[model samples]
Target: MMDGSMFIDEWHPSDHYMSEDLTRPARHRTRTQSPPRYYYIDFGISRKYDASNTNPLELPIYGGDKEVPEFKEDYSKPWNPFPTDVWYLGRAIQETFLDRYTGVEFLSGLVSDMMHSDPAQRPNMDEVFSQFQVLRQGFSSCKLRSRVAHDEKRSVFHFLLHWARRIQYIVRRIPPTHTSLA
Candidate 1:
């Protein structure tokens, strides 16, 4: 069972706790065995409507209809990208793989490619399938640990590179020294 919290956690979109229970109250040895009960209750009207109108906290259901102008798009683009986070696949991977993805590096790369901000960078489904096949072959071998080692080294390299860039930014932010006038 997966859910999209969107914004609220303890409560749903309507700004109220779901008084309605998600499951039948059952007897069990411990609370840990029970499945989490997440229900949609909060009507985050603001999410649907603009902030300026949410203050009243109610939408006029009857005659308040109006046309919202759609944003113009470039016809040449192959895909119309979503304006929201594409995090559902990551969650699905965690659930499906159970954190034991054989080709962890390859899967990470797939996720990264999917999450690339530029639509042009995203791989097509066929390319993704081909890459997965290659990764599966690498993970099946036990004799050579090079594949896993490569991932570790790459992670370290990226970490160091990020750190170095951050340090450079901080140094650049430092005030310049004033020369002595003597």
Candidate 2:
């Protein structure tokens, strides 16, 4: 099942901060270091079904995010959790990333499909991954290396300050997106 608990502060490793800011430093300001790794947890509701069973149904067990469309219509009916998992992932990305940042417009199509109200209309994991690959390949390395700006407009002072840091990052060849050492 797609539990919203998949991502939380506890699941991510702490970063080695070089500044006093309580939040994560901006990409340009971040020091060159191994990127933090993140993983999922809370498998209290997870299941492992036989490979032969393509459609396994289970009763709803509400997760961290209670906004799933399927569960809203009928709470007691048995439903396949696979498509719901796709919805969870799509909604998570939509809320956590797309809504808050710019430069990821390429993901809109796939996210829309995954979050379809009709579960059967959603693409399977393999299709999702394939589409993601195509999207990823479409971006040039320079585009990928460019800074991801926030959706909100910054004040004039902040904008100039951000550009100053951006120039420094460009000169130093610091990547706009952090990478894992492994």
Candidate 3:
């Protein structure tokens, strides 16, 4: 999580560019060490299915990006939600990074494939990850390393500040009489 509050997948403008205030020393500036790694969270609704079960449970689409065409009422048939997840991820990446940044043509095709309207056309997670590995190889070493370094530094600062605040809160809560315990 960037800044301990925003998820990288959520795609806020701040995630792409650091504001001056955030870059200041007080905010615990991020170091430019390695490429930033993203983590997926919020798995409260996640489920596991056995591979033998050809017909996985298909409940009516409830939460998530409302723009998914398959979620329409007219599409009464239950469909695998996995492809929907791919679409959402693609859309998030496109809208958040590709749309705002330039010189990432390598990712455009992959993103397009992921966002294909037909779920059958979309590549599976393994294929997507493989493609990403290939594409990442094309990035300039300096650029990739610098980006990672910056994010790492920022993360360190955020971690330290969070702990500091917690400690401060606990210290304040201690009774004054307990300050000089024998």
lDDT of 1 at 132: 61
TM-scores for the candidates: 0.28, 0.68, 0.58
lDDT of 2 at 17: 28
- Candidate 1 residues lying further than 4 Å off, grouped into runs, are 1-91, 94-106, 143-182
Best by TM-score: 2
- Tens-digit lDDT string for candidate 2 (1-182): 22223232222134432223436532321332233445567789888789888799999778888888998987889999999999999998898779987777778999999999999999998899988877776777567655556767546775776677667767988765554322
Q: How high a TM-score does candidate 1 get?
A: 0.28
Q: What is the lDDT, from 0 to 100, of the residue 38 in candidate 3?
A: 54
Q: Per-residue lDDT for 1-182 in model 3, tens only?
A: 44423222333255444443455222222322112345777878776778776446486456766777677655667878778778888888888767765445567899999998788899876788888877766655433422222223457675677456445544666221112211
Q: What is the number of residue pairs that collide in model 3?
A: 11
